[model samples]
Target: MGARRRVREVRPTDGPLLEVEDLRTYFETRRGLVKAVDGVSFELIAGRTLAIVGESGSGKTVLSRSVMGLLPQRNVTREGRVRFAGLDLVGAPEHELRELWGDQIAMVFQDPVTSLNPVVRIGRQITESLRHHVGMSRSEARAAATALLRSVGIAEPEQRLRWYPHQFSGGMCQRIVIASAIACGPQLLLADEPTTGLDVTVAAQILDLLQRLQHERQMSMILVSHDLGLVAGRSDDIIVMYAGKVVEKAPTATLLSDTRMPYTEALLRSAPRLTDGSHRRLPTIPGAPPDPSDYPAGCRFASRCAYAQPRCAEEEPPLRPGAVPEHTYACWYPVGTPHGAEALELNRAGGAVG
Candidate 1:
């Protein structure tokens, strides 16, 4: 907390709040160049929740980090436009990014323990952004910090503010982190696997708190997670990513009702359903994701996809409009199509689908 200054209010814009176009984030590693995020593109409307759903190493985290400008400078290359509030973040100056980081945009990292300072008191951590970005005095910032904690459903927030990170449970610490992220009233919130490590009950509570806060603040959010079930109800739109690319994207209801990509179907099938009995074994994707350093020339999921066709290996499919206007997928033999049915039958008849 520091000297107080008047903070200006932000006006709403008509266009999408964030527009990522042909974004690619590659890392230089000993093995070779690892394309963690390649040619990804999407738009996030203001006050809406967009979910990026994929398995681990599917470039979900890397995509978030690229947008947040949190990737390491050395041994990394970022290409393409990350437009937010009409500003191109990819080409923006470092100082400009710093000014916007906690003020206009904030991120809730996966691990609260690593994200939070172990030695610093929770109050200081929360108030740091308030004072620096919001220009609140120490006392005012402290009061605001307490209110933030209280808003996140922390009881006795005033007393808890003085506690260290270790004093709180994992879920409580996550609440603290969320409080800090929303302290400055950011326009956008990027929550990367916010529910990781928490028990199912606690995870549900955290997601509910986030949804409530997003509604109250009218802030747009991008949730990055692997669990399709976790984001099914929470997100308005969902983007399914494979090895460094988006395989499917659609409105939540549309995606759930009619999934086109085989990878997306596999993910949905693998998820534990309430209808599943305790005696039933959970469904699983047969093979692992492709290595990023040496991805195949054609469709990345062709090897494991049950409805893959010979064309899937011979030629890469572009993300194209599906039967619906808002739904899109990158698969030559999409599910629910005649070609997909033939491919499935071929696989069943001991013939290679691709």
Candidate 2:
């Protein structure tokens, strides 16, 4: 927003910054134990962007919260390891987790309205992290907060500092949220649907700003979104989740080119194409996602998959390696395979698939 550019430098790690192994986050409810995140594992290398894509209620947000140790206590039970920077956060102390929250790891939540305090001044909120984590003096934190505001494309940083969240536009409020999140230069940034409640142009601007900031800060980012097309070119690696489990994972280019999971293919098919005419009818996925409290013994996507066989309804598919080195998918009859082809044909003949 201003002429000055202040990009905080973070030391890059040779290995993964965050390593999640068989992480399961379950909440005990009156209905039953809701398995929010079921045995998810992934490695996020420093300075790389990992996009977790899935439809709503797919546990993308829950997985991010679990990695950040942001889940609530009491009824929630978390199993498995969430290692960040070589330290396991699963059973870490509350004081230690609090320290890592705004310092080494920061999160940009979906709604900017909820991310910021309506009553607190913008400058104060941004400076709080710098003062608490960075041990900056009052004046130093104030100056740094101004610089942070500018870095996130907020103009008139000095004046805007006195303004409240409701005083700014939706996109501007999100920028302020980003400024606060990055004030301390966290090594890992978790942005969960950062573009929510914004127009298309503003959404693009927010995404581009995040990418630019990540590169400049040398920060490993987890970009959580429900749209595959949204994170297509923005992420280095992509993980497709369904019903609390990761169904497919691969490098961005490879996953799009050689997709093995039927669920992933269905998502791609349902997405609106850029070259399509304006009046074209949008394709929709049949059937709804499975309920978390009552998960199926079979494949999570079996009910909605057109290529699903009788075995799919009886057996759960394990996450296995694909033809490509980096690609992995959880599907018995994978896309482009003879079994999948025959299954799809059978479904079409019997009026099961559109």
Location of the lowest summed lDDT over 10 successive residues in candidate 2: 1-10
Query: Please, what are the lDDT tens digits per residue for candidate 1 over residues 219-272?
Result: 999999999999999999999999999999999999999989999999999877
> lDDT of candidate 1?
0.91
TM-score of model 1 (CA atoms): 0.96
lDDT of 2 by residue, 168-264 (tens): 9999989998989988788899999999779999999999999999999998899999889999999999999999999999999989998989999
Return model 2's CA RMSD, one decimal. Answer: 3.3
Give the TM-score comparing model 2 with the true structure, all chains together.
0.95
Question: How high is each candidate's TM-score?
Answer: 0.96, 0.95
List the global CA lDDT of all models.
0.91, 0.90
Best candidate (score: TM-score): 1
